[model samples]
Target: MTSSPTRQRGSKELWLDAAYEMLVSDGIDAVKVMALAKKLNQSRTGFYWFFADLNALHIAMIQRWENQNTQNLVDRCKADATNICTGLFNLMDCWLDPSLFDARLDLAIRNWARVDADLEARLSAADRVRIEAVAGMFRHHGFCDEQAQVRGLTVIYTQIGYISMQVAETRQDRLARVPHYVELFSGINPSPHEVARFLARHV
Candidate 1:
């Protein structure tokens, strides 16, 4: 009898994981079938079993990023918390934690969208969802619709700027600024407990 395939040799998740790493580390241009196959230490032909083509692989990578970084973050914010500020703090954790956020992947995808019209449209849709999620967090705290929307935009836009600019700041510097940004976004200073929890997760 023929032996079954080895887990290390090939799997959809393995391919997507390798592609994600490449896209984050080397940019989208480097996430090719042969490149991934080489990284995974498998034959390029094995890729066809999991993905139809390169485009399909790229699509899968986008979905993977969306599910992990976007949907997961929003869901965590929606988790049971004491109040809206706590929920917002949960969301901010995504930015502070590299494993949860993947800012490099986000930057790479935004760069890809610059040249790909389809990706641009998809990214625009995602931004709408993300902005609405942020607005919901504000509304939960009794903010008016307009105020919530404006605050939501401010938080997300500030995060995008921080990521895209690749700002160089020490971890201590960023930790010190967290409470200020939290207050700016929510219009209330976070409690000592909240700040401690947030810092504990990051620092």
Candidate 2:
């Protein structure tokens, strides 16, 4: 059989993408250089031509994830015209959708980081980026800096906790309970007007 054409991504970009997929689907242990090369239908030579080794690839993956996903989200929030709650809710909706690259990879990385110190540090850095973005949004919505920071951490942590808890729950069950959780997090009694306003601003 003829060989598959050498996959063409910039040297750095290709490895980053491969590492991201491996980490997401399997975990950090899945990100071997040879494995990545095989996944790309290439030889180890292809990987070596770019990265010095697997550790180098891992570092590049962490940096690329931070720049592209974490930083990008922060930038979007900074630019959003919606109020803090609306912007944050929109963010949560995006995170819960598996189709989004950032969210899918984030879930994978978070899972992997649970047992790996280096991975945990990378994940923590990304989390701080998100927390700061949320805090800025809250400040824009009339919260003082210190209060916004606290509220932002609470909102972010609550969202993460909810998702983690729902990992084994039926989608229907999770969907049914989302509003209740949202209400609790937002500290607002359930009301059609408030939800309408939230959707109008966010959706």
Candidate 3:
């Protein structure tokens, strides 16, 4: 018989996934090594095979967030687009698709940052990188540096408000609103062809 997920040996990925889930679902205090072992239905000894200690696992979790949430959004911001609306739609895809960005992880990290200066600094650095990518997108599409920066800040800050307010909405609900959002953020309505193209990917 196949081993159940709980019965499987502790791999690095498994340990990190459990740690990440704990971090997101119940905050960093709940991400203890013993607790992660319990969640995985494995012994503490098995966790040691993958992570030297709780702190190592915590670092791995933060790295995962940096890769999965922050880096992905920055990449999407720089993705190919024929127009500003199309470009903003790429950014919207990151927001609407959890696979592109883990909103819960982002929120949890922000909450944890409230108590940790090191983490807050890391988060601030990531914010700068992501906001600049958005600004760069605007600059490429014809906005001046100052205008691009303002629009970029507005785009990211609005989404931060949404994520901080608990991840915006369901995919279908949010998808319906993307065109209006893209228009408002870019100050130009997307053509029917552009809107159709963007919506087709999500729908």
Candidate with the greatest TM-score versus the true structure:
3
> What local distance difference test score does each model get?
0.84, 0.68, 0.89
Please give each candidate's TM-score.
0.90, 0.71, 0.94
Error of 2 at 75 (Å): 2.6
For candidate 3, write residues 22-87 as lDDT tens digits: 888899998887788788888888888777887787788889999999899999988999999999
Positional deviation of 38 in candidate 1, in angstroms? 2.2
Q: What is the C-alpha RMSD of each candidate to the true structure, in Å?
A: 2.2, 4.0, 2.5
For model 2, how does the per-residue alpha-carbon lDDT over 1-116 read when each residue is reduced to its tens digit?
75444553236577778788888778888899778878876778878778888878877877766776677667656765545445555555544444322655666667877887
- Sort the candidates on TM-score, descending order: 3, 1, 2
What's the residue-level lDDT of 38 in candidate 3? 86
Cα lDDT over the full model 3: 0.89
Tell me how far candidate 3 lies from the true structure as C-alpha RMSD in angstroms. 2.5
Q: Model 3 off-target regions past 4 Å?
A: 1-8
